[model samples]
Target: MASSLHIDLHKISKFVNLSIPALFVVFLSAGHFVSFYFHFFTVAFLFMVIANFFYMTVQKEHVILKNFGLMGQARYIIESIGPEMRQYLFASDTEERPFNREERSEVYRKAKNIDSASSFGSQQNFDPSEIKIRHTMFPTPKEALQPFKITYGEERGLEFAYTITRPIMISAMSYGALGTNAVRSLARGAKLANIPMNTGEGGYPEYHLMEDCDLIFQIGTAKFGVRTDDGLLDDTKLAEIASKPQIRMIEIKFSQGAKPGKGGLLPKEKITDEIAKLRGIKKGADVVSPPYHPECDTVEKTVAFIKRVQNVSGLPTGFKICLGKVSEFEVLVEEMKRQDVYPDFITVDGAEGGTGAAPKAFLDGVGLPLLVGLASIQDCLKRHGIRNKMKLNASGKLISPRAQLVAFALGADAIYSARGFMLSLGCIQALQCGNNTCPIGITTHDPELQKGLVIESRAPRIANYVHNIEHDLEELLRATGCKSFSELTEENLYIPSDTVLGNYRLNSPEVQAAAS
Candidate 1:
């Protein structure tokens, strides 16, 4: 009886499918005979339907299209817009990954210089797995908090040692990774905020130098702005870049948090004439940087390279890395000690860091998160008795003052925020940074899209966002009974017993010693 019913249903389905097109033809014929306007409308509608039907049936690419015909097209249309629908209509404020509505809204509020205080209780889940800040009975006065400042290369006695007054500075967002307008606005904003900006490895940093802001020239594996024809570091070009008054420091990037082992990928579609000229690459092809520097293949070579860059640039020089294997870092540190050639600073980019484009495996599965990496590195440096030799800068999803405070407690000397500043310039978290279709023009190079990001309007917002974060940082510092970030210790942070951080803390010798 079931088999017979299935057969009957199949026949009925076929009949309905055939009858719908026949009915459409009859309607079109009637419309043609009835009225000219009706005929035109029916003809246009039928043409679209017929074209879609034929295309879906003939298309062999999608299995669903071949099987379900026009229904598959409808499904695809709905699926294509699923992200937008979920983001705007269905997803809760705390549901989204990377950045949720609540987080983005906080940044937006701060960027607009509006009050970002919450009315109701916290939306955060206070589960046993959550980390919390431990408050003391006696809170420190706001006036007692010291001004935040970190001097790079001061110990090394470099001629152009740079002092950063703010703990939060804009992280590396390259020109080719971002649009021209976006870069200029960020530079202007950095100037207004009195914070330094890292000129990402996109070469030359023309736009970054246009504004009167302190800049850190980054040299990627590709050596974009300061590379020879064979893609090796060019000392002459490096010195020239360092000579710029705005160029306060130079960072040799080993790897970023987003793609620790993988190189940066700039799509061919986004590459323009200016980007090509600056990067010293061809304009018509995708630019894939090397995974590691050609000259610094071994631990010994890496140390020598740092010293070489520092000597040639005549400025504070550092290296950035996303911590992977602890033993590998131990070897590097050991080598640095042997050679007595330490970088001025070490930027530890966490796995949660943002990037324009990276493979899913690297982005999601690779490298250590900020707190873990920062704490591990701190422990290692302290154990090796080199903690005070160099500054430890942290980067990854550190947008809020609370987050920055946690980083401070974990041993981060300074913080770098890329997406935070991007949000200040009105990024909608569209997740189109990889493509040349950023709706807000922050990431895309498309002229039409770039127009949406106005430098004059957006620059001040960046300044506002920085100022607000600084203000909140002071407030949070006062609440913690700490005079400054320098005073924040791991004891101030309470990690859940069942969490990964808790496990690490339990295993940490430092934590164990403190408990003993």
Candidate 2:
């Protein structure tokens, strides 16, 4: 009985599949009798359908096309627009994934210089496992907030040094990784905010210097901006970059949060003549920076290189890294102690960091998230008795006041944010950055897309966004009985005891071994 029913169903399915083509044929024949235009369109459409049908049936590669015929193609169309559908139409504001609607909306509002306050009640679940800020019974007096600052590498036995006036600075987003207009807007914004902007692995571009903003020149493994013909650090190039009065500090790229071990990867399509000239590399191909610095393979060499760059540039220099093995950091600090040298600061990137492009495995599984990485790095630095010698910068989704405050509580002296600033520049989080077609021009080099971003206009939005964050941070500080950021500590932030710290098993003995 089941077999007969199955046969009947199969026959019906075949008839339905065959009926579609039969109907098209009927339409084609009817159209021929009706009008020339009708007939022509029918003929063209029929040919396309027939070709698709033939390909579907004859091609054995895709089982869906072979088994389900023409209807199977619908799946591909739907899959292509799945992310868009989910992002714009279906997903709720609170649903957390890659920067939920709420997060994006907050940035958007702030960037637009609109009110970010929500009325009625809180959207967050006040669950025990959730993180909570410690509010004192006696709050500090609320007053007009002032722009905050943190000085590093100043009077620290360096010929030239830096005093970062803003607690938040722009994180590394390279010239090749971002469009010229985007870089210009960010530079302008940084100037407006009186903050510094870090140029990523890609060489520094002139647009970054156009606004007279302080710049932190980053030396990636590829050493693009300051590299010699042989791809080694060129003293002349270093001096040239240092000579730029706007260039304030230097950062040695070890690893970012997005792809800890996988170095910078700029798609071939993004490589333009300007980018090539700036980076001193040939254009028209993807640029994959090496995973590790050639000049500093070991901790000792890394420390020596930092000192060398500091000496040469006569500026504050530091290294950026995503937390990997705790022992590696410990070893690095040990080397720093032995050499009596250290980078002016260390940027600890959380695994949640954004990237222009990265492999899925590296993006999701490679390094520790911001809080854990920040804690571990802080612990390691303190353990080696060198935490006070250098400032610690934290990145990776440290966009919100709560996140930033938490970071300070965890021992971050300053914060760096990429996606947050991108949002300010009108990034809708399309996640198409890896490709050359970022819809809003935040990551694209295409002239047409870039035209949508006007530097003079978007720069203000970036400043507004930064101002909003700082303002909110001041409020939080006042409520927490802290007169200033310097008074913040881990005791000011609280996480539930039962909270599970992802797959790291952070509470486990092995993971917490380095924790103080």
**TM-score for each candidate, following the candidate numbering:** 0.93, 0.91
Tell me the lDDT of candidate 2. Answer: 0.82
lDDT of 1 at 313: 94
Model 2, span 1-516: residue lDDT tens? 466435554465466578767767777777877755666667766775775678566688988667766666777899989888888788888895788888888889989989988999877766777777899997877663444677778538665667876678999998877888999999999999888998887785577888889899999888988887667788788988988899889898899889988866656765668778888877777766779888888778888988889888888888999988987888888888899998889999999999888889999999988887887787777777788788899999987888898888778889899889999999888878978799898798889999999998999998998889888888888888887787788678776666534333456444577685
lDDT of residue 420 for candidate 2: 92
The CA lDDT at 207 in model 1 is 84
User: lDDT tens digits, residues 1-516, model 1?
Assistant: 466436554455455456657766777877878766666656665765675577657666887656555545667899999999999899999979898999999999999999988977888776778788888888998777788888999888777888989889899988878889999999999999999999988899988888879999999998998988778999898999899899998999998999998876667975778877888777787877889998998999999999999989999999999999887998999999999999999999999999988899999999988888888999999899999899989999999888899999999989999999999999999999988899999888899999989899999999999999999988877888999898999889888867777887787777688899
Candidate with top TM-score is: 1
Clashes of each: 0, 0
Model 1 TM-score is 0.93
lDDT of 1: 0.88
Worst 10 residues of 1 by lDDT: 4-13
Using lDDT as the measure, the top candidate is: 1
Error of 2 at 197 (Å): 0.7
